[model samples]
Target: MSTDFTQEQESFATAVAAFCAREAGTREQRDALAEHGQHTHNQGLYDKMAELGWLGATIPEEYGGADGSVVDMCILLEQAAKGMAPIGGIGPTLITGAAYEKFGTASQKGAVLGGIVAGKSYSISMSEPEAGSDVGNLSCKAEKTEGGWLINGQKTWCSNAHFADRILLVARTGRSVAGGVTRQERGEGKHEGLTMFDVPADIDGLNIVGIGTMGGKEVNDLYFSDCLLPEDSVVGVEGQGWAQLMTGLNIERLILAAMMLGTAQRAFDDTLEFITQRKQFGRPVGTFQALRHRVADLATEIECGRLLVYHVARLVDENPTKLFPREASMAKLKLTETAKKVALEGMQMMGGYGYATEFDMEKHVRTTLVSSIYGGTNEIQRDIIGKTYGL
Candidate 1:
């Protein structure tokens, strides 16, 4: 895979960097915008990105978006995260937008995609209390109703749901069919009867409660008790949610990998600044052999992560409709694991300061530590990659 950026891509990166510096250059600014985890973003800043066409980076031009490539979107996310910008909702919004553009009906696309370009964010609800990695087993049922579907179940870890305009929901609609046979007939029927829906957040019978987490108020638990969605809300064909989910997951993993790459870079840059200034034994701490070697290793590792992430981004751009499952999984696994390692090492190197909330190291640690678990656990990624190799 080629790892080089063209002049246009390079210019775009530069512009994003400048935007980050001006908007979210300080920890205090980020804290104020996030409001002690009560919110996932600064709406004002988010609107600015939309107005500047950054939020619509992945959207098609017909929907008032830039029609930019996946690689461009990756660059924008990397810069935003590296600068600690308060645009955490943008990733999910873009991912949700992609799914809508692909499978949504004309009206669904008009509402969701139009909102996305107009600076509205969305949340995705795939993981239920019982279905995280094994999403095919999701029990969130949506029964047929008079005018629509009556959904009744619980969805957990729904990020940005509290403030999002809409949700991309996956629920079980019927029985599973495995290899042209049912599970009761002695076949693997783990991935059937699933359907996708575009649920408005303010719909009656839908309740969202904030879930306190180490990563702040970034996620919530949702209860859908007779949540009524019109028949037109279904994104694609019923009983095809598994295939639809595969498409979204590819982009989701790539977006996460890009964010982690930026996060790793941020942690390394912060640690390097700390060691270069703090003196010990009458010299800068970075001058010590052990500390210097570790820094060098981390820098090299981050560079490798960058190449892997961008290579996957390029593949995605080249084949937008094709699912590069193996490559996307590899990128997600490598970057997330590397991010965790880099953050932990940076914390250890920073010693006391790293453990304090006053410093950004602790925040980076909190964020990167969960990267492995969210976009499907690193173990799952490894399993997927191995299977592609005929393991």
Candidate 2:
């Protein structure tokens, strides 16, 4: 079930694995970092990766990146997740980079990608209290002014916004043209009139409040009262944020898929390790037929997920302009669902140890549990995939 890779890619993955083993070697170390509010890797680890040119893995060489392919990024992310490396910041940064690369102005690209190569993180803010999966329904308004745009709205579930160097803020720019009525002014079928803005995290009137969650402080609610941005803050054309978002969603989903694949493998590996060592009935519990079969099934499923994810990554890399929505959605749906299944099964198999904080299985369970909910819920993914078939 493993994705086929060239010798160079394999070598790179091996190096990443070795790095993880050294930096995030044990569950205790990872837990300690997480306890200190580094839900993903700390800034030091990020800086190290940046120095190694891993942070700009997907950006082109002109922008200080290695000009690597998406497949390369998938390899890096999968290994990071498997080793429990605190590199969760990479995904959001990648998406933000993708957006800037495709639709941003020259200055925007220079600033954002330059920051990435310098180990700065970025996060996109699209989901509002009313938006979420229905991102087009977002009501965050950015009205045109003499100098630039005046932003005022609330965005929830904005992961990394609290610490991100810049927030890729998507807001309503024009009024919906339907029936000559402005949707933002009226509040229905509001898919148009959206624009993307690059706002610095420390901008005036921007307040990021961290939200408590079972997983930790991974997301936040951003309130913008009088946030103003210069004319150059817009990523692309005004009233085209939806198209811009669509352009990056494929990459975003693939990034999540890779993370989930690694997570599922880690859970399975942890469970295997636990069962082989913990004895029962005067023998190893892994010897039980039922448990053995379960492990085999999970292994097979994980391999399948890996193949699908890499396949999609390759397809997107081959045709960046084409929206392989079906393939992208399939990858997200499968890996997320499989990750959840593997974590839950690993927890059940390990019993008390799985539930204990000393073990990583419960943490895996918590993280994977939300995989199906984020990056456009699995339900939304399924609907997108189904629509591809003209269903």
Candidate 3:
């Protein structure tokens, strides 16, 4: 399939790239921002993006969003990744915004979605200490109380929690294992008992402890100690969080795939430039057949990665009801793996220069490595894909 972007998409990407190049391209600036324990220090840049109507690209215009398409968001994300902008946590924020638009009460939508479009941050709290991949086993419990629900549990690996204004928390309200409970008995005719709560970040009992990561962003361990919320906090019908989360997962995987592809393309471009400039044996290194072949292979893989991601995005936009677990998994797995491979090959081709902090390749390596581990590991993606084949 042809992978070229449309004129509008290309224009959007060019705008994002130009913004990044002007505002966040220097090593010193990035390191300084990283040292402050901030994800991205350019709220000015973010605000500019928001002003350009890019922040809430996929949400409806009624909610102060751009009413853009998911493919548009992918284009922006790919551009950010290529620029190595510190906007890694943007996917979760956008996903939470979409979820609010989909399942939130009117008040919830007015508050959360409006704030997100205004460039306020948010996070999704799904992973716990024991519930990394097995989300159903989450120990975070939300029990009904006089007014609403009281949440008491801890969530780990929650990115952007430290700076988020709210968290889209998935808490278990009843006991039900996968395939073992009747949908009607629990509440309705689907996965039930699990509920999504819009918990404020500064709630009385909520605690956020920053955790260091290799990519210079800080994830957090969030403890919800009897954190209480009003009745309006629950998203959609009670006991339908699993299905809701499943719907969001498809978009989440596609976003990550786009980011991975962007990084891969960046790595390839950096390697190409380096090989063409650095001379070895009185000739540019890129003139060698071996390095040329390696670049060709990486370019081909990157093309495949882009196609897989865009195809999945198109499918999600075209048919939201049809389950695409395998397709999503395949896209996530291949893009992440390709990102790592491209980064490694880029570094190897650049030799000593690649290891220098002044060079972008080192940062690319670190960032791409972290990408593989987050948004579900490639190994887990394989397991999901295998199970789809009735394994």
Name the candidate that leads on lDDT. Answer: 2
RMSD of 2: 1.6
Per-residue lDDT over 235-281 for candidate 3, one digit per residue giving the tens place of the 0 to 100 score: 88788898888877788788888888889998999999999999999
lDDT of 2 by residue, 111-136 (tens): 99988988999999989887888887
Query: CA lDDT, every prediction?
Result: 0.87, 0.88, 0.82
If scored against the real structure, what TM-score would every candidate get? 0.96, 0.97, 0.92
Instruction: Report the lDDT of model 2 for residue 138.
Output: 81
**Which candidate would rank higher by lDDT, 1 or 2?**
2
- Largest TM-score belongs to which candidate? 2
Ranking 2 against 3 by TM-score, winner: 2
Over 4 Å off in model 3, which ranges?
Answer: 32-41, 176-192
Query: Where does the lowest 10-residue lDDT sum fall in candidate 2?
Result: 32-41
CA displacement after TM-score superposition, residue 273 of candidate 3 (Å): 1.2
Candidate 1 local lDDT, 1-391, one digit each (tens): 2358888988988898888888777777777888854465888988998898888877888888888888888999898889888887888888888888899988888888889889999988899887899877678999988999999999999989988999999888888456786662463576778888989899999999999989877999999998889988888999898888888777999999999999999999999999999898899999999999999899888899899889888887887788887999989999998889999999998899989988989988989998999979999999999999999
Candidate 2: misplaced stretches above 4 Å?
36-38, 177-180, 183-189
